[model samples]
Target: VSEELLFRGVLLGWFDRLLVERPSSTSLLFLPDDGRYARRGIQGEGWRRWGAIVASSLVFAGLHVGNGPEGHWFGPDLLPLFLLAIALGWSTRQTGRLTPAIGIHMLLNGLTVTLILLGASSS
Candidate 1:
C-alpha cells in the first residue's frame, strides 16, 4: 500500500502530469501533430507513455539497489525489480488509478514471502 502510493500514486503520477498532461512537441519530439497524444489521464500515445513508464520503473529499481542482503547493493536484483516496477506502473496507467497496482504489489509480495517461508520450512 505504502510503496504503491509512493511510487505509482505519487512518483508515476507526477511523471504523467509532467509528460502526458502538458505535452509539447519541443519536449517530446515523437509527439504527433494530430494532438492524438492528448489523452485525459495517461498522456501521449505509445512511446511517450512507455518512456514515462520505463523512467519511473528504473528509478524504482534503482532505489532498491541497497535493499538486498547485508545492504551489499546487488546489481542482478535490479533487473527483476525493474521488471516488476514496470508491470505495476503499467497497471496504474491502464486503470488511471493506483488500486490495481497496489493489489498486484501485495499479491507479488505475499507470494514471494510465502515461497520463501515454505522453502525455509522444508529445509
Candidate 2:
C-alpha cells in the first residue's frame, strides 16, 4: 500500500501530469507531428513520458537494495526489480489511476511470499 502510494500514486502520477499533460515542439523518434500522439492520450508526449517512467523505476529499484537479503545492495537483483517497477509504472500511466498498479504490486508480493513459504515447507 505504502510503496504503491509513493511510487505509482505519487511519483509516476506526478510525472504523467507534468510531462504528458502538455505538448512541446520537440519531435521525438516514433512520435508523429500531427498531434496524433496527444490524441492517443498516454501514448503521446513521446520520450518525455518514457524518461519519467525510467527515472521513477530506477528510484523504485534502488530503494529495494537496502531491504534485500543481508541489507546490502545486490547488483544482480536490481534489474528484475527495475523491470517490475517499469511494469507497475506503465500500468499506472495507462489506467490513469493507481488501483491497477497497486493490485499488481500486491499480487506480485503475494506470489513471492507464497513461493517462499512453499519452498520452506517443502524443505
Candidate 3:
C-alpha cells in the first residue's frame, strides 16, 4: 500500500501531470465522452508519456539498488528491476489509476517472497 502510493500514486502521477494531458478539462470533467477516455491510456502519445514512465521507472530502480539479495549498484538484478518498474508504470498509465500498478507490485512481491522461502526450505 505504502510503496504503491508513494511510487505509483505520487511519483508516477506527478510525472504524468508534467508530461501528459488530462483526458478531459477540469471544468467539464463530469461530461462523458463514452469510451474515449478509457481508450486514451495516459493521454499524450509518443515520447511524452514514455518519457514520464521511463523517468519514474529509472528512479524506482535506482532506489531499490543494493537493497535485495541480488541487489547491487551495478548488478544483474538492476535490469529486471528497471524493466519491472517500466511495466508497473505502463500499467498505471493504461488504467489511468494506481490500483493496477499496486496490484501488480503486490503480486510480484508475493511471488518473489514465496520463491525465496521455497528455495530456503529446499536448501
Candidate 4:
C-alpha cells in the first residue's frame, strides 16, 4: 500500500540508515494512526468507526509480526508497531492526504534510527 510505503518505508529505512551511519544517539515515537486521525476530527461516531481503526491496526501489526523471525513477537516491538499503524491510518483519513502523516512518521523513524546508532535507547 502507498500509505505503508510512504510512512513506514521512509521512516524505517531512514532510521536503519541512521543506525548504520551514526550509532550514537537518537529517539523515536510510535504513534497510532487513530491518534493522528483523532487529532483531525475523530468524534464519537458510534462504535463502528472506532472499531474500524482498532481492527485495521491489529491487522497491520499482525502483518508486521508475520514478516519473519526478524519481526518476531516482542513486547517492545508490538507496542510501537501497533501504535504507529493506528496513527498512520488515522492520519490518512484525517488530512485526506497521506503525506503529512508519512512525513511525521518518517521523522519519528529517523530519530529512532539515529538514536539506535547513537546508543541512546530503543522505544
Candidate 5:
C-alpha cells in the first residue's frame, strides 16, 4: 500500500540521476533547479494551493501505476493508496511542511500491513 518508494523515491531518484546523466534533457522534462524532493511536492515559500496538492497526488499515483501488476490495477485495492497520496499531498501543502505527510503515510502503511496480517491469520 505504501508505494511511496516507487512513486516518490524511485521516480524522483531516477529523475535526479537523469539530470546528471543527461543535463541536456532535463529542461525538456521540466526538471527544476532545486531537486526532486522539492519538485515532488515539498512546498517552498507560501502555503501551496489545494489544487496543487490534488495535481501532485494524481501525478504521484499515475507514476505508481507503472511498476508492475500490483501497481497497474485501478480497482478498490489501489483506491486507498491514491487517497492516501492525496491526503499526504494536501497535508504537506496545508502546513508547508513534510513531517505531517510522512507521519500519516507511515500510519496508513502500518495499518495496511496490520490488516493484511490479521486477515491472513483469520483466514
Candidate 6:
C-alpha cells in the first residue's frame, strides 16, 4: 500500500508533471481522471509519457536492490524488474489511477513471498 502510494502515486505523478505539459486540472496525466488519453493512443505526449515512465521505472528498479532475485544493483534480475516497472507505469497511466498497478504489485509481491517460503531461490 505504502509503496504504491509513494512510487506509483507520488513519484510517477511528479515525473508526469515534469514531462507532460501541464497536466489535467484534476489529475496528474494530461487527460482528466476519466482516462481519455488512452484511447487516443498516447499521440501528442508519447515522448513525454514514455520519458516519465522510463525514468520512474528506472528508479523503481534501482531501488529494488537486495529485494529478491534482484539482489544487486548490477544483476540479471534488474532488467526484468525494470520491465515490470514499465508495465506497472503503463497500467497506472492507462487507468489514470493506481489500482491496476497496485494490484499487479500485490500479486507479484505475493508470488515472491510464496517463492521465498518455498525456498525457491534464483530467478
The per-prediction tally of clashing pairs is 0, 0, 0, 15, 0, 0
Q: Extract clashing residue pairs from model 3.
A: none
Lowest summed lDDT window (length 10), candidate 6: 22-31
TM-score of 6: 0.74
Q: In model 2, state the lDDT of residue 96.
A: 84
Candidate with more favorable, higher TM-score: 2 or 4:
2
lDDT of 1 by residue, 9-103 (tens): 88887776666556555866875556555553343356667778888898899988877545758677889999999999998988998899888
User: Regarding lDDT, does 1 or 2 come out ahead?
Assistant: 2
Q: Write the per-residue lDDT of candidate 5 for residues 24-116, one digit (tens) a residue.
A: 555647755667644444443223344444555667766556443355556554565568677776565466556676677788668878987
Q: Which RMSD does model 2 reach against the true structure? A: 6.3
TM-score of 4: 0.50
Select the stronger candidate by TM-score from 1 and 3.
3
Best by TM-score: 6
Q: Report model 3's TM-score to 2 decimal places.
A: 0.74
lDDT of 3 by residue, 1-123 (tens): 788788788887788788776555763478676766655654445577788889888889988888778656778778999999999988887888888888889898999899999999999
Every model's TM-score: 0.73, 0.72, 0.74, 0.50, 0.51, 0.74
What lDDT does the true structure give each of the candidates?
Answer: 0.80, 0.81, 0.81, 0.57, 0.56, 0.82
Estimate, for each residue in 1-123, the C-alpha lDDT of model 2 and write its tens digit. Answer: 899899887887677678767545464454667767656666556777887898889889998866655576877778989999999988888888888888889998899889989988999
Per-residue lDDT over 1-123 for candidate 4, one digit per residue giving the tens place of the 0 to 100 score: 465664444543343344323222231134434454443333434344445555666766766663433556654567777898878767765666657666876787688778767774543
Order of candidates by lDDT, top first?
6, 2, 3, 1, 4, 5
Q: Which pairs of residues have clashing backbones in candidate 5?
A: none
TM-score sort, best first = 6, 3, 1, 2, 5, 4
Distance from true position, residue 4, model 3, in Å? 1.5
Distance from true position, residue 92, model 1, in Å?
0.9
